[model samples]
Target chain A: MRRYYVDYFLIFLGSFLIVYIVLPIAVILVLQIFDFSMLLKALQDERVLKALKNTLITSTATMLISLIFGVPLGYVLARKDFRGKSIIQGIVDVPIVIPHSVVGIMLLITFSSAIVDNYIGIIMAMLFVSASFTINSARDGFLAIDENLEHVARTLGASKLRTFFTISLPLALPSILSGAIMTFARAMSEVGSILIVAYYPKTAQILVMEYFENYGLRASRPIAVLLILISLTIFITMRWIVGRRRYA
Target chain B: MLKLKNVSKDWKEFKIENIELEVKKNEYFVILGPSGAGKTLLLETIAGIHIPDSGRIYMDGIDVTELPPERREIAYIPQNYALFPHMSVYDNIAYGLKIRKAGNIDETVRRLAEVLGIVHLLNRKPKTLSGGEQQRVAIARALAVQPKILLLDEPFSNLDVQIRSKLMEEIKRWRREFEFTAVHVTHNFEEAFCLADRIGIMLNGRIVQVGKPDNVFLKPKNEDIARFLGYENIFEGHADGSRVRIGGITLSSNVTTFGRIKVAIRPEDVIISKSDGEFEAKVESIESFGFASKVTLSINGLKLKALTTTSKIIEEKIREGDRVYVSLRGFNLL
Candidate 1:
């Protein structure tokens, strides 16, 4: 009887969690559909489109920068054995744990406040915070490959760099793509750091915050709803593509 | 066509020291060793993945020790058949050619896949294939570019026993058919016997011996080499001519041993008889193998194993704690 009671409690707890977790997203998606006219107006607005374009451009730049710089670092982290590796890894992961506002301050200190006020500041901040995702995922992807494959390619008359591009990169494509998606998405949603560093040319998050602060929920709801829909579409499509790839 | 001179490496836990070996052109050289014996390390060193701390590698009489793997023109196949997962089988096989900027990459992949009997798997992804299919594809991918030499590092270790044997035969046939020179590293003796024209026995990162398979098994230069080759029954005795005097009994042997010599007898070379004979031994244990039965006996306080057929066990009713007469077969005396 005690076992049966415990089992019943577990069942209820699981169902409660499932419902509670899913309820807010479900409510938001449904509520937006009823506000179709507002959604349409927001979508048609040039300001929304401009913010959207800015967000995409910044995210792509961040993603490319991460791939360019972080991938080699990740590969070294995964494959090389040396002193201070743990320390280097800890440093790489600092952005994920540090406060976003503090990251903005750190960028201010490093790049100077004037520099932070420029477009480069936003890109740098996004790279500093979100680049870790790409590095970590690429590291994991490179690590999953057999060291012998590289050796085999080398014996088969391929140089180290050639083997890396041909075998290692191709094999780690799925993980790298997932990492790219994650970095892009994280860059899109970042508000606190960008608000501090680059605020003149408004991003979508900045626009939403401005609307909310100036006109309250009625005016901001449409923009907030628009941002959520855009994020949702990109996130969902990227997840589907990742799901379809062969992970091994 | 391949040579390593004074190659030495220390990889934290494993080390290969001052290793020297050579291979002739078109020879299928197999490095046979146990796990962690530095077989893979040597293969990697040859493939230029790990730069040897000290040594020179020569290929076709030219020094290539410092050359990158690509410039060396060797092919390698790793264990687990490391196929590119995102690419289809055809694309995976064509990658090397495409990277080299070779003409008609499609033609090369198709011909190689067809030779390896993996043509039907061209459109499929690596993960969707069976172990045998994946292995074939990996080999085909390496062979497609027509490298100067091929190196295999425990490539079939993950395969099932049945498939391993079948593939072993196929690889042996493939080498002859294509006149491909290969350096194979494996822990399996059966594979070495099946595929290797010459075998190099490696231990602790050094080649202890390299020769024809039969000679290495029969005439080991040292006790260590003998022990590594399954010569389990090593006994200290005095040799007078072709007979070794052990305790108070003497037996004829093929091994040329003098004073203070170690004599090794294979388990299959001992003959066991019931009833009285010149020598007496007590049955210590009995182990039943599928084709034969092994009976353990203590001959004058030394434990020795004797092999007999299953029918002999049934007829003689051999079991634990039975008195038996053990005779030396006088052959395979290491």
Candidate 2:
């Protein structure tokens, strides 16, 4: 009886945060459904379409770049025990805790005008904020694998590179895929750094802010709904693919 | 043939120090050691998974100390079999052939699977196999490569008792069938006795003794090896010639040692008889281990352990306080 009461109380407490997260998204989706024609109009707008395309391409490019660099770093971090390992891992996680505007400033100082107001600037900003997800996720994925598998592969006449490709990489794929999904989602939702760094490439996020400032919430709300819908769709679809791959 | 010339590796907590060893071609050398004795590290060192801080490893008399595992023509199966969970059984068996770009991949895989009784499991993933099946698959994968040396690290430690013995028998048959040299490591003495062509007793990161299984089992080199070998009756005694004087008894040993010596008697060698024998002792305790009972006796204040069948306890009516005659059938001096 006491256990039942504790369970009920715990769930009631948990529902507060769950509802806090779900309420706004549910309200926005519901409001957009009532003004569904506005969402269609926003979708048809050339400016909106261009911004969406820019956001999609830049976010995907950021994810790919992160995958290219982060996976190797993650594998090394997970497998090796060299000097300054903890320091390197701490550095990998440093970007996550930094303020987004400071991240923009740091990139601005590091790369200067070479990346300013361009697709490279947007990607650099997004990568700065989102690469950690891929690295940490890949590290955790590689860590979860049995090192003995690689050892066995090596002993069975597989070179280190071959073992990595045939055993380690394939075994850690689900985790890497999920990490890629997070990287893409994080890159797509990034607005603060892009606001300071590359506002001209006008991602859907930037367009929403611009439309709101110029024409109030009524105009911006449709694009916001569209962004939410697209992000959710991509996120859910990627998650489903990862889940299926994992079990398969 | 494989040889380790004083190979040593210093791990964080465990280290194998100056591991000097050799395994002849087609020999099944079993390294018997307790856990944390660095047996796996030693095997890894031999397999080229780790480079020794000092000393050299030679394969077929060629220095392979600096060679990578892939170039060494060795196959290692860690405890739990370490099967490739993602690959099918057939693909796993074919992995080495694929790497070598060897011809007849399908024929080799199917032959190994058929021999190991995993032919029906060709397309099944490792996650779906039982422990014994997984072991057979691991062996099939390792043997499919036709490695010069096969290294197994406690391969049967994960299986049930019945399965373990059955696999041990199967492994022995497989060795004859494949004709490969193997260096197997395990903590179980029964496994060592059953599978070892030559047994090396390792203790505290060192190979303390190595010889034929019967010789090593009968004569452990030191107190630690004796203890690890399950000699329950070890005592410090003074010996002159063949007679060793313990608390109040003089036992005749085969070895002639000096004034101070350590004597060990396996519990099974200490015979407890109902009729008169050599020395008289009072039964102090009796502990039953299902099939056999360990009878602890006090012979003139010196405690000794003797093993007897449980049925003998009932037949002889050997109680805790009963008087019994004890005889030392065999003893070794260390």
Candidate 3:
């Protein structure tokens, strides 16, 4: 009888969480459907299209850069124990803990002359706040693999590099793919850092903010709805892909 | 053939020291030790997974201490079998041939698979195979490489009794067919007894005794080794010439010693009689073990264990608190 109440309480809490997270997106999606012409207009507008394209390109570049550098760092962190490893992990999470605007300012001061107000600046801002997700996810993935697999490969006459590429990389692909998805999604939605560093080539988030400031809520609501729909579609599709590949 | 001379490794918590071993070609040398006795560590050191801090390893009369695992023609199967989960059975068996670019890879894999009885499972993933099937695949994979030496770490520890025995017989047959030298590590006395050409008893990181199975089992050098080899009744006795006295009983022995000494007697070797014969003892406890019953006898504040057949126990109607006679006819001095 006591367990029954506890189970009911848990169900209530879970339902509350689901509704709290989903209501806003549901409301936005339904609002855009009511004003279908505005959504179509936003989709066709050149400025909106350009901002969306810029967001996509910079987010993709950020994901690529994270893959290039973060995966190897994650492997080392997962497999080896050395001095200052905990400290290095804490440093990797610094961008996540610090304010995004602070990260923007730090980037502006450090690489102002080279990348400020350029396309690279947007990618840099996105990468700064999002690369940690990729690193952590990859590390967790590598941690799940049995160390004996690599040892067995070596005993079967595989060189270290060959074992890493042929065995470790394939076994860890699902986690790496999920991390890439998160990197892309985080990069796509980043705004506060780009606001301080590179506002000229506007991303979708910055464009939404600009419209809301220059205009009223009524004028900017449609754009928000559009961005929400696009992000939701891509995120869900990517998650589905990752889910399918996980068990394969 | 493989040899280790003064091989030693130092972990923070445990250490194996000054290990010396030599395995002849096509001989299965088993190192038997209890858990946490650095058995796996010693095996890994020989496989080149770990570099010994202070010794050399030789294979086929050539020093290969500094060589990496890939450079040495050694195949190691870990305790869990460690099959490549992402690959099919065929690919798992063919992995070494693919890496070495050996000719007729499919022919070799198929032949080995047929011998291992895993020919129909070639297309299935390792996760889909049963434990016995997966082990057969691991064996096929290791043998596919045609390694100079095969190393198995507790290969039969995870199987049921029936399967364990079956796998043991299978491994022996595989070795005969492929003609490979092997170094097997285990803690089970039955496994060591059934599989070893020569047995090495490891205690506290050292090989305390090494010889044929019968010699090592019957003549343990010290109390510790004797205890591990299933000598249940070990007592300190005063030795003078060939006679030893223990707790108001004098026993004759072939051992010629003249001071304090320890005597070890197997529980089965102590003769039990209902009528008066030798030292009298009270039955403290009797535990059944299928074919035999372990009878614990108490005599003059000393506890001793003896093994008697269940039929004998039933015929004598031996129960707790009953008095019996015990004779130390076959025992060894350590």
Tens-place lDDT digits, model 1, residues B247-334:
6667876656677667788787788878646568888988887879888889778888778898888898877888888777644444
Write candidate 2's Cα lDDT for A61-174 as tens digits. 999999999999999999999999999999999988999999888888898898889999999999999999999999999999999999999999999999999999998999
Whichever of 1 and 2 has more TM-score, that candidate is 2
Model 2 chain A TM-score equals 0.98
Output DockQ, candidate 3.
0.92
Docking class of 1: medium
lDDT of 2 by residue, B66-98 (tens): 999999999999997899989998889999999
DockQ of each: 0.55, 0.92, 0.92
In model 1, the runs with Cα more than 4 Å from the true position are A1-21, A27-53, A116-118, B102-111, B240-243, B253-258, B275-278, B331-334
lDDT tens string, model 1, A1-248?
89999999999988998999789777766877887787788889898778877887888899999999888988999999899999999999989998998988888888786656566888887888899999999999899988767766666556788888878887777888888889988998898888888885668888888878997876677777777777789889987887787443
Which has the better DockQ: candidate 1, or candidate 2?
A: 2
lDDT of 3 by residue, B1-334 (tens): 7989999999767789999999999988899988888888888888788899998999988999888899899999999999999999999999999999999999999999999999999999999998888889998999999999899999988788898899899888987899999889999999899989999999989888999999999999999999999999999999999999877778898868999999899999977889866789989999998989999998877788999898899998999999998877689988
So what's the TM-score on candidate 3?
Answer: 0.97
Off by over 4 Å in 3: B275-277
Ranking under lDDT, best-scoring first? Answer: 2, 3, 1
